[model samples]
Target: MFSEPEEPTATRMRRARATACAALKVEDAAQNPIWGYAGRTLSGLVHGSEEDGWLRVVSETAARAGGRLWEGPRTASFALPASVPRPALHRIHDWTEEGWSYRAELYAYAPASVVSPGPVLDTDLDLSEAWWAGLGTALDALAAVPTDRVSMREEYIRRAVAEFTGHAVGGIPWSTAHGDLHWANLTGPELLILDWEGWGRAPYGFDAALLHIYALRAPETANHVRKTLAHFLDDPAVRVAELTVCAQVLQAADRTPFYAALADPVRRYLKRMGRGAV
Candidate 1:
């Protein structure tokens, strides 16, 4: 029995990318790019003019939520300095000039994220102990950026509490957080945090709590995160943050397979901590 020849993966990717680009109406979009795709939209990271900076084409809804999404698929650029370790929204472009209605927005790209060794849930990252110190420094730097982005609010916490634990959430210490601090959003080797759209004030330990929960599949890594960021996780407000993130994870398990392994442990954690036992 003879088998049909297979299409080269590169060729397949190129074809798919071409289709996506054509759909987005970005004729200038790079062929091979780092894609942040969700549902029907595509956020492709591509190079830009040295003076203008990089470009990122994202879904219209997502772009509107962060930048100027209501401005009719327009482009908005940030004046952020290059020294910052964030891919802050630089500029956004609407497809209206091209008379296209694909419901996508283009953005000026930020500094590329570091090449990760592996997924955060795969295993303990082989980072140096000194790198942990640097991680603290980087987090501190991120915290210093004054932003109004509110990743989680009291109502969100209350809903999660009522739906999952049925316990009232207490006072939470608020601080600037990188709302989505997962392995995929984080870049390593050089330790750069990606995706700043979620940067904003949140419960004190919210970021660390989320990170620890994601690391649960690998207990050793989870333990390491707890130990390293103990100052944040050890706070009294951590109870609220932990429940909040766990509830959020449980909710997410229904939608994405990424949080499948986390669903059970998160429930157990909520039961333990939700009763104010922790």
Candidate 2:
């Protein structure tokens, strides 16, 4: 039972109309179709603009970098670059009445080829261990890429480590990280990682730490994850230190609403580690 804010009806209609107009401009099939307003969070509301024969409109507040923050529209445009996930970008407009909006080029929403059991919030220590093991494999795959090839911000990485490690205790390991790796951002049975807005290179353990800390709110689950992660690495101490830094940076960012659910011990641990770097 989450208490989510309701988007106004007039605003919904405006968004729907905008999606419809954008669809027509793109020469997508179907003129009039049912529109639905999806979930709203601290970031912004998700609206399914129009679902006709061939296309659908999915729009929301554009998320920011450095952290998982949402800022209003920076600029308006009809076509977005290939870097954007969608096929075509219809129109980008700023509305004083309705924040920034963009209509993605229409695409069919396909059902997942395989669907796992719905997310189980309570701890399944065994399952968590397996998940962590899989996560490690993913991280290793990500890390194999040469650092120079990836578009990682050196300043950001420097600041992150400097903020977390007062003195250079030891050199930090480098790798590309998802930046924010959480369940909600992931979609489909294929688990194709979506929401690449916060993606960039970071220290090796950042993604693992973020995922572990988020999952470890439950003591049993946290311990299980830690154990799983331990099996993957050569140096447990360094992994712990990296995880500490990730927890602190994540806590400071205040990205997830579920932060409130984190346990006091974990919170205290993060605060202690964060103080060392900041």
Candidate 3:
């Protein structure tokens, strides 16, 4: 004979309550449900399914990191300013169990945008020229301000140059930067840029160089990026050199996994940067 044990519905509800009670400071724990579509990340994407509406659970690790980065309450206390268009943080909570404790945040989920499935390099959108001009404008504005007045640190500048100087010929002009700008991080129409974790001022061409090097996979496209940049920046050879260095540094850091996934031409650019081949 065989026997199995099953909890009654009331017992199951109690268990669920205990779990929620341990995790959150509940003003109320009503069954408020929500749904989420799958979103992509550097690691991979979690797909949405019909069986369960997407649960926006913030784990302890994420709560801790957010607290460290934002220097505030871990959960349910505050929200980022509305001026920012990235994902919204709904609430934060702490969960405790035997010998373990963790923090987490609940987030309002937005449907994933319908993104083009082509390689970043081959996208025919070809705003290389516009992007180039925008970058130049941004750089010129940044450079007009004295470095001492800006928040940029000398060490950061040096590291930027050192990271890419091998491939580029000379120094680029210094300026403030968005730090990270890529197609994936951008939203259409609104041009809302997210993930401000690393935002700061840096050299003038740093963002453009990063985008060109990482997104333009084909040599022809890369050449186009270079031409656009040169034209927009008025063919400033010194600036180009500096930008190349910055690009190399970005490629090396490989923060976005897309850069790591690139094939030979991309790798070659990085290698050239290391050797100052440009």
Task: Output the number of the lDDT-best candidate.
Answer: 1
**lDDT of residue 21 for candidate 3:** 36
Q: Give the whole-model CA lDDT for all candidates, comma-separated.
A: 0.57, 0.42, 0.41
Residue 28 of model 3 has an lDDT of 23
For each predicted model, how many residue pairs clash, with residues at least 3 apart or on different chains?
Answer: 12, 2, 13
| lDDT head-to-head 1 vs 3, winner | 1
Residue 83 lDDT in model 1? 37
Question: The CA-based lDDT of model 1 is what?
Answer: 0.57
* TM, every model: 0.70, 0.51, 0.44
Per-model C-alpha RMSD: 7.0, 8.5, 11.0
* Candidate 1 stretches greater than 4 Å from native: 1-34, 40-54, 61-84, 87-91, 97-120, 271-274
lDDT of 2 at 127: 40
Candidate 3 segments whose C-alpha is farther than 4 A from its true place: 1-122, 126-172, 218-257, 260-278
Query: How would you encode candidate 1's per-residue C-alpha lDDT over 14-73 as one tens digit per residue?
Result: 444454445544454444455443322334554334433334433333223344223322
lDDT against true structure, model 2: 0.42
For model 2, residues 61-164, the per-residue Cα lDDT tens digits are 54422122222111101212222222222333332224534443333343332111211133433343344455556555654544332224545545555554
TM-score of 1: 0.70
Residues 104-143, model 3: lDDT tens digits: 4433344443222322454434443454455445444433
